[model samples]
Target chain A: MKYKDFNHWELAEDAYFVNWVLRPNKHADKFWKQFLADHPEKSEDVLLAREIVTNIRYSDKPRLNDTEYNDLFERIISTKRSKRPSNVFYVREAQYRWVRYVAAVTLVLASAILYNQYWLSSHPSDEKTIQTLVKESPRGSKLTAVLSDGSKVKLNAGSKITYPKEFSDTLRLIYLTGEAFFEVESDPARPFRVKSDKVNAEVLGTSFNVRAYPDDRKISVAVAEGKVKVTNADQSTVRFEHTLLPFQESEINVQSNQVVKRELQDDMIFAWTNWKLVFKEEPLSLILKKLERWYGVEFELKGAIKTSETYSGSFDNDPLKVVLEVLTSQDAFDYEIQGRKILITSKY
Target chain B: MKVFSESSITSNGELKKTTSSRKLSHQEIVQGLEQGDESVLGYIYHRYVQDMFGFGSQFTRDRELVKDSIHEVFASLIARRQSLEKIRSIKSYLFAAVYHRIIYDIKKNTTFKNKNQKNNYREFNIEFSVQNRLIMEESNREKLNKIKSAIKNIGARQRQAILHYYYDGFVHEEIAMIMGLKNAHSVTKLISRGLKAIRESIAVVVVLFMTDLG
Candidate 1:
């Protein structure tokens, strides 16, 4: 029967009406409201039908209890865990293949230089002392290093850390570029200082992340676990500095020397440490830059992007192509990838 | 092969590949699983195991068997992720995979004692429950039971379409994919027909009640 011919009881039995009551969305709400307004007499029928649809109970469908679900989930995870060793082996194999090639070349050169210095009767006493060690993470990878004072530093992609082999009695200092998370060993007598190009972060016994990429317009410091003192390192007329507490972040604009401080959510600031990327309403320009550094690829923008265009999203260990696909899906853009470079253009 | 070799080039080349592995989407998780990433396998399990188990239970009363089928489907997905084609909807793909596994298990065990089980497996059914607080009158309760039975009397395909669409909250396209229909049009037809039958049955019950009351 046509919907117009149906009485209140028959309207109540209509599946579309019942489904609308079960799960109402914007469109459904509009349609039902319009229907009620068009046929005021059917209002009681619509209400009764909704009641009937919501009241029908199906007792025959099989159900899995919560305990069963949890048990099954654990079993599946355990099965994957049992197979993890082989996966780890493959990762190690892939890592070592490159490490071995680099190590071999460096080892041969080092041995030749050492032999020349010792056996050629050179005055070794005049040689410069190698009192500092420099550790760098390439464009797409992160690197962790242990300082002589037992503190650990995690360097983000395309970053570097230079530290002394031995700490001085007065202070423990490390030079940083790009970004790094520092877990300083507690020694109240000696302050730990990280000197980046644009900013210097000092702490007594705390952990924090400092991001000071040279080309970026701003430098930011986020405190994760402890307090930190951040000061402008640039030799400019006006300097910006701030003392950041736990879950606090400070950003210093390089061009204007304006400092902005605010409370930060742990996930937003420290997701990178767990290998996740979280961007909240960040400009497309900044997102692309971060993606370029994280993926080790060059992004050439071929079209104009509005300055106000921003994207907020998070990803946890996805390939570059997939991440690019998701980003472009939202905006009107097309991208082409060639070897190590990606060209993004307007989708017109 | 070229990708692997490129990853071993220099620190610069390594950095590029390393960054690519930082964040994962659903598609990436599938790709990672294929590449023998145990973490991705764990991720897929945690994300969809409950939904899969609920859907699988419809085919059989054996909860353990349903659980086993879910486990087997995921294990096989991990084992075959490398060769598995790109899936458009992870949810529908998983539902279809688990559905096939349960059907196969049922067919395999169709012995003399399992003959009744075969009949039960052939028909798709869902349990519906009304909120206890909403049932205020005896006649309303009677009307609800009539509608529930009417839903059962509809064709199996119609019942499956309604259950998948309404109860499971799957879109028409996803329901079509899961139910092996030609397209979403078929699913829409099945659901409408099922609802029509229920309406007819409820109308008859309503007339009988009114006449008896008079």
Candidate 2:
């Protein structure tokens, strides 16, 4: 450093000295403290230099306003999105969801096979996939797949489905972690079964929706066009079984091992298939959770939410900002959007 | 100073590498850059926008031109990410890239503007912020006054070299690349010449401080 002859002006302009003053860490502190101890005569100059650098500010510092920042951010993101991998098979998102998902979501579909493979290989303990084909959707993206049996599957966000590229002659089976809608091709000889954690839905030839996210307490199987046989996925001695017809939904309480059945006026339980968020008198907390996966954003509530109250609204392929604005319009809350994160707060 | 053991303090010319990590390593950023990771690009943008803007403004007065040049630098960085040549320092690379892009824009538009516009804008302009930290002390103010005069006395090229070395926290090697100098030895020479001017002024302040104490 030749710092013995270097005065405070020269010391203040030293790159290492300025870095120590501005961006301090243990190593920098140690280095400077040692310098002070070694050069007691120069300590006064070093201290004055440190003070100058600490208070130094640039005069012509430029900044972009919120609108300008977001405009530039979007422009750059759009430029990158066009160059995203356009191959279909590599994208683990649902084949049908890609259409509406592209129109509504922030991220355009890119093949996650390579990204997912990297994740899967790194995380070997998380129940390795044995199936020939693995289809997965990250938060905020939906994927579609057509099984070898001609059955079409729409995989929801933060979910994974594993099935053989070619189904075996004996029986067709697929494992589910999150939620998915299946339109099983009629195969009388080989039954199509959706094996989940709590509920196993077996159908001969029909279309149905299964909600079995690992975090959810209840796993439900709702039949839309055909009969579905629901059975306990647990391989214990006492096996529970139930059959559900069209317009019927079966909720299996995972903790209680109890089964509840309900009838709907219409088989529109799968409104999400059309990219519609339908919540009829649903609690605000639950609605926010659904919005997180739908828009692929995180919501941080600042104040106390009126948990006693329930919300009922249907957002059909609306942007997340609109959905949040509409939700908090009459309610006691406010919202702020930054990148993929949204902060929602209650007024009182 | 001779190379202080950088094993703990500063890894010269290495961004995102430190005894205290900035959470992203150079290898990780390069890997993410190749994959067109927007978050990595965003991190780099947020980290260096001020420096980039300041560096870009030195060449031209048009704010939009500076912004466009900044945008083009990032766009090209991403477009050519897969085959990007080795980038030693992201900050210096962006600075040099922005410099070239603004120059190119200015060159193309020289038809409408005067032919001497290139020479007029060829200078590196810098002004230290007048934030008074030593406002309370007379001798501290005198110390600052000497520095102001010294900065005024230094050559134009030496001022730019000092700015890159001190204000931007760039090592001599990175400053060499950014300033298009032949090598780091020249960068050290340029900075030392500038520092000597400032040091001489500070010496006069030291003599004044002794007399004031007496």
Candidate 3:
């Protein structure tokens, strides 16, 4: 009979037969062993299913580990840096505000040209460009630059940059990973785009910095001037953009695609540019994310304690001991920071 | 299956010793794990890791993934060990948990579950090993290929249920839970129907084989 002729009961019966004979549990093995004795003709089918199931069970593709895990941890934990600080061009909105607008306009034009030449070569005129960027920087190396039109960017170590060579007239686009400080140029006719691995940050004429790493689910953008929009790529049809008024910071969680915007010390947004740890009621995950970047080590958390409890405090280049002490000070928590891994628990 | 073959399982003789030194009972093991006792965790790993790893090998021959999945199972057990009362049997619990985790990880990385059934079957086509390879005296390789093709013609869901439950010895409830069934009854029905289909199809081919022999 055709499979379609089988009623739900019949279908379920065949399903069970295939599953039972193919994957043989104690129950199925006993049942089928008895079954073949009564209906000897059914033996071939049972054997076929068993062989097929055996084959399928053994067929699986392998998963590879992230080779850069140690390097990522090192960058998060260590503070030692190069003495030859090559004129690090840190761009704030105040110093070169006009450069932001120029960059924004150029981003728009570059995107338009790239879209026409690549994406819209055969399509009708109403074409939109979907730009993607994937950039990664090595450890101890930081990238500082002003785009052709004037948007300033300061890239942190172990970061990635992928974007269209230029922005389309309608939309300006760029992509980032790791961390970067952005001074976006403003243009009402176009919206500048910085699509991180998990998020898309957009703005007109504003000065902000975004720290978004692919491996880490948290994407942080702090606005120092004008307004900004940070959208979750995993969610939203038209991009979730946060209009960042000055002195405000927003973190977008990639896993849940949840956004949290908070007001903080405006100076802290630019503080990391000068080597600092700024914590304002941050979760252990956020602190650990930053700590792992500053120190090259891994953290292994075990036990019954929930790691989401918020810790409120700030430190500027303080000793690593103080950081661990502050984390362990909570009555509900205790921690041990070993050479390369920190183990946090509720036993304290 | 590859990892926990009879050879490796038998080779780890010390692991099989029925020591009378008041070894930790299941409850004690759960308690120690909940209390964050590394010794208890290590004991469980030593006792169960090979079996689980071997069982996982049947699912995929990727050694690293099997190792990764085995570690995840232990880690999850530690995290949930506090509520051990809910687990009826640690044996079934660990097996089902590892199976689900492996499937989820595979689905996420490959995104192959939703594609056409033919591609799915192709992805799972088994390559015979050098030493253990079946050598049919009279039947040629083409006949073996036909048998494989016939097996692939089965439904994907039926095939998965059969493979996980029959080959790995996973119970109906466990299979139901992993396959996202509502209850054991559903799994029972699914296995039954899948088997009947295979049985009927294979019977026809067997008859044809007899006729050809005559």
Candidate 4:
């Protein structure tokens, strides 16, 4: 049927016309282009109908925020892990069910221990050591410290480093929560170890960054020079250990006990040292997490962001609004800032 | 419904690209999922979970149940990723899968005490608003209100059909799959009928307004 005679309202009501207006594929575009050419007088009707279809905003649906989405995604991914082919040792269907139950119990216990350790480490009691010096970088700032051993430590925002004023001849140990870049002096006689809640990185004389924010489920160590050994320090009997040379990084998932080691590009591992935040095709959720840590702001996402969606850009000391505006420019989302909180939602 | 045109100009004047660019297509995502790629799975979750939650919530007001159903759907998709055939419309397939899972869960949890409660579940209702200031002029206020009421008065199934077609950008066949209709033709008919109802209502309102003016 010829669409030329249809009024603007009729065209708007037509499913095909509405589809063309909202999302014109190649075929739809071709057809509409030809139709406009054939009946130039109907262009206004078509445009008006298109405007109506495009502007009609539907009621907002209840959506899971970024935190909720990430939480649910973690659950889904972990559940998948439990059913992996490698776990086929529990081949019998009934036995598989039993193993899952046992695994669930073990997970609960493991996480509880991890949480306890994180709490204790973050709030180390005053009675523990009189000689220890604690340096803290409040939100929106970085702190640098020189240990007695001549090692340099650059603490990220909202991070704290606790170490002894004088290093023992046996070992040089420091505790960190949040993120830090360390340039340890080469002392083969005494290996240096940086401990976080979930993992420990030991080195003889190497520079590396350790990110183990208490709220983050994963701990990452990116080595910049020399060799560093990373080991999962959770109280679980089965431990994970990995060694990283220069230009290597390892991430340990605290909950699933998964370790991922990969080669690191210079920009990927060390950009934050230069006061720049670089994300090489990272998910919006992970990017949000990093932004929260760096800027010490709360981010609340209001709509569904596709799992396949990723963003890649670098920001150097940009305001939170500028960074957000740049990120949301390509995606059909909008962001608003209220004090220290940013709310992001899909734009209608 | 509209196909995802990847070339639309974004707010910042940059060309929009799909989350799944050349490096990550639907097939690759499915393959990654089968290979237990955590990031890929996470990407899929970010993409569809909210819409799935919204659709599932339509069947039941139990928010917990809806969340559970969505979780189960993703878990199952991951488990079966290796066996799944190439998916044509990932969005539609996901919508259908989540819809069926929610219905199954609701049926399994049905009880005599809650049997009547099922009737209390609200039908799908779409709130239409005109945001264009030009259209919001005083002259168009009556017409806008009429359109809004007309939308509100449409049948539940019709409203759902329109929502899936327009807002969700699902094709007629996909809408049919999500709604469990017989075929795509049925979806087309449902939408046309719904629009016709709205048109008739608006016509009546316009006639009454004109008569009052005369």
Which candidate leads in lDDT?
Answer: 4
Give lDDT for model 3. Answer: 0.52
| 2 against 4, candidate with superior DockQ | 4
In angstroms, how far off is B95's CA in candidate 4? 0.8
> Residue A14 CA error for candidate 1 (Å)?
50
Name the regions of candidate 2 deviating beyond 4 angstroms: A1-32, A51-57, A83-348, B1-22, B120-153, B199-214
What tens digits encode model 2's per-residue C-alpha lDDT throughout A1-348? 476788887787676777777678999899878877888998878867766555433335566543334434544544455443434532412221121111100011111222344234333444244346788888898988877766667778877777766666656777666677775655566777776544567766555566656666666666653356777654541266767755567666656656677876543356676556677666777778888887889888798876546777665566777777777777778999988998887787
- Rank by TM-score (best first): 4, 2, 1, 3
B-chain TM-score for every candidate:
0.70, 0.72, 0.60, 0.76
Where does the lowest 10-residue lDDT sum fall in candidate 1 chain A?
A102-111
Per-residue lDDT of A1-348 in model 3, one digit per residue for the tens? Answer: 253233323433455665665455898778757866876665554554344445444334333222112211121112111111223233221222232221110010101112223334322343554343344555445667665445557666555555554556776666555667665554556666766434556766544566655566455666654556655543342245566655566765544546677875535445555444566666767667667766545677777775566655555445666767766664466778787777777783
The global Cα lDDT (0 to 1) of model 2 is: 0.63
Model 1, TM vs. native: 0.41
Q: Rank the candidates by DockQ, best first.
A: 4, 1, 2, 3
Q: Top TM-score: which candidate number?
A: 4
lDDT by candidate, in order shown: 0.63, 0.63, 0.52, 0.66
Each model's TM-score for chain A is 0.61, 0.61, 0.48, 0.60
**Cα lDDT tens digits for candidate 4, B40-159:** 766676577778888777767765567667776776676663256656777788888888777776765678787656543544667655444323434667777777777788888888
Error of 3 at B174 (Å): 88
DockQ of 1: 0.11
